[model samples]
Target: MMWREKEQVLMFTFTFVIYAVCTIILFNIMYRTQPTPYMDEIFHIPQTQSYCKGNFTKWDPKITTPPGLYLSTVGVLVPLAQWLGWEVCEVYFLRLTNVFFVFGNFYLLYCLLLNLHPQISESKLLLSCLNLSIFPLTYFFVFLYYTDVGNLFFFLLMYTFHLQGQDLVAALFGVMAVFFRQTSIIWVFFVSMAAESSVYITMKRTKLEKKSSSLQFLKKFISTTAALPVHHKKQFVNVLIDILDTCGGYLLTAVGFIVFLYRNKGFALGDKDAHVLCFNVSQVCYFLGFVLVFCSPFLLSPGKVKKFISFCIKEWVLTAAVTAVMILVLEYLVQIHPYLLADNRHLTFYVWQRFLGRNSLLSCAFIPVYIFSGWTVLQTLQHKDSVWQLLYILCLVLSVVPQKLLEFRYFIIPYVLFRLNIQVNSYIQLFLEFSIYVFVNAFTLVLFLNKPFYWEGQSEIQRIMW
Candidate 1:
């Protein structure tokens, strides 16, 4: 046992070292290729630099996000920048802050996998870490001064602590995640739900085990109180009490988020026009396509998918009703908000215009795509009835549905959560997934570095390019 434990440690060390080295190489390539600020960094870098100079009150009027990123730099990196006496390098130093957080995220993820699945082999754990490293945005964001990585790091930390049953610590991290990015409230909700659900499931299972016979268990499963003995009723009441206790931390965190939002003036600070709550069917289709692309490897087994669909078919009517209601509600909500209907500057807007030729009729073609996407999410939820699984699917769908704007970066957390839920059984599958990630990363990196003709007339080129 001792020898095996040592071997496991060595394997993990080797895998992590390789990940760090490759990440450094990629970061360097991206930094050297385009050292200047790109896209959002145009606002981010200046705002962060202001923080470095101890000007907390002066924020860039154009930058809408919270000051979490800048504040974090001022707290840690600013002192280092002063020590190095590097003027121009300060910006690069700020960008490099994410590099450390990237490594921190990897370490947290490794720890999380261990805690969540102690039975997992060291080799498999290493492969999982590698899978995380290859996630395009993981490397891509490291090159820019963005809140995505920082928020992700805290999000993972929240999950890691939650799995360890440190509820208060988990809640604290959740609050930090929201501070980094407003959308991270989704994670707070997920963590809370996961904790509550886990407690309920465990208590329910224990109570079921105490029942005298299989028939009683079946009866309890079919109907909550039907045929349940008097003793089980007392146990059910106790389970509800336990669930409330377990959820205290999450409730505290939720309150904190509400307070923070209230103090900050609203949920987000950026140009509200850039993102509106609008019902865009095509955007939903694009989001589905995005998920399919990122999660293609796990979704490869048609047999498993068919089985999930077959199981869900029994509730087909209910599912259809819920989906239709959700779509209609979202459509109605979109018009109630003041949002830009058309922004050619956004990549999604540009693509739709080019392919659909600005014709409203072409939009109808995406109806089937939206249906398939909704079914895919429903199937995933049916496949795993765990609290975490349900929350993951809900957050993934919710994050995309209300947004008028679309960006690949928006899906990073969802992708990470999805990948965590999947069990990669073979080296071949891991290799295939890794290869696809690398190809996509390379393709996107090239486009970002060498602005192609298609990128012309885009706001990104005008504002972000050096």
Candidate 2:
């Protein structure tokens, strides 16, 4: 048994090393092809360079993100650069730093997958790792000086510690995640739920040994209530109570988030106009559409789709209530920054303005899509039926729905988590997924490398707007 375990470890190591080498080569190719600063790097690179110069107090006014990334660079590369007396190519060094984190992110993801599904085959594990490394939006960030990769790393670390039952360590990593990217504060609830789920599962399993009557009663009650007519007041109340019991942590987290925003003087930072929340139903559709596209591989199975639809039908009231609440929250209550809408160079902006006519009809048209997204999320929760998984899905939905800006990169962690939770059983399915993944990344990379655009009258820049 030990030998078999050793063999598995050796195989995983060999596969990871190969993927890492290929990723490094790909990064180098992209770097050589387009070495200039692009997108947010316009601010990220310059700020990091300032850090290299020992101007710790200096910050780029245009960079809204916290100084974690810059401070990290200063802590690591500044010393190395000083030791080597090399002051040039600071941007490249920063990108290199991201490259290191990129590798770390991949490894941590692999560890996470293993912890989540210990019975997974080596071949399947390798495929999962490859899928993450080549995930279109995430792959693009590897060659840039962005905090996205680091955010993913810390987020995965939090999950890793959670899986190991190290709740405090996981919370610490969750704090790191939030510091790196303020949006990551959602993980506080996610981590809390995960720990709570672990306890719940353990207690339930222990109770199973004694055939606890409460467990039996709860199960029978749920099954009975699920079968009752929707118009039944008792049934409705029971279902509502069940949902609240399951989701109470999320409600508490929401309150904490409000407190956080109050303390921070509002959720928007740096460019306040660029990140506010507002009633933007189209943004929710856009993000959900992205989720569908990203997860099309898993959704392709007829059985899975049928299962998801059945789950929605089974819990129609819960599903409808959640979906309605989501839409209402997004439309009337949320604040929107509309960063993508502000940038005219991207496809999303034109889609909203020109194709969609910026009308309510467009929002109404995507109602089914929104319902489908909600169903998919609920299906994920039901499959796991764990407090942590439910909380994670809630947090993910909350994070994206309120944003007026739509970016594929924002969905990275959720995408990874979703993919991990899904089971891909067929080689044909795997091949199709790999094909789509490669095609998407290749197309995006080529478009990013060759497309010409101007930002603020700076001519001939090759950058992806989102």
Which tens-of-lDDT digit does each residue in 40-66 have in candidate 2?
A: 778888877877777878766667667
Alpha carbon lDDT of each predicted model: 0.67, 0.68
lDDT of 1 at 425: 63
**For candidate 2, what is the TM-score?**
0.78
TM-score, cand. 1 vs. native = 0.78
For model 1, the run of ten residues with the poorest summed lDDT: 332-341
- Give stretches of model 2 more than 4 Å off: 197-263, 279-284, 304-338, 350-363, 454-462
Residue 384 error, candidate 2, Å: 0.9
- After superposition of all CA atoms, the RMSD between model 1 and the true structure is 5.6
**29-126: candidate 1 lDDT, tens digit per residue:** 77787677866788998888877777778867677667878887778875665687656335577888898888898888888777755777787787
RMSD of each: 5.6, 7.5
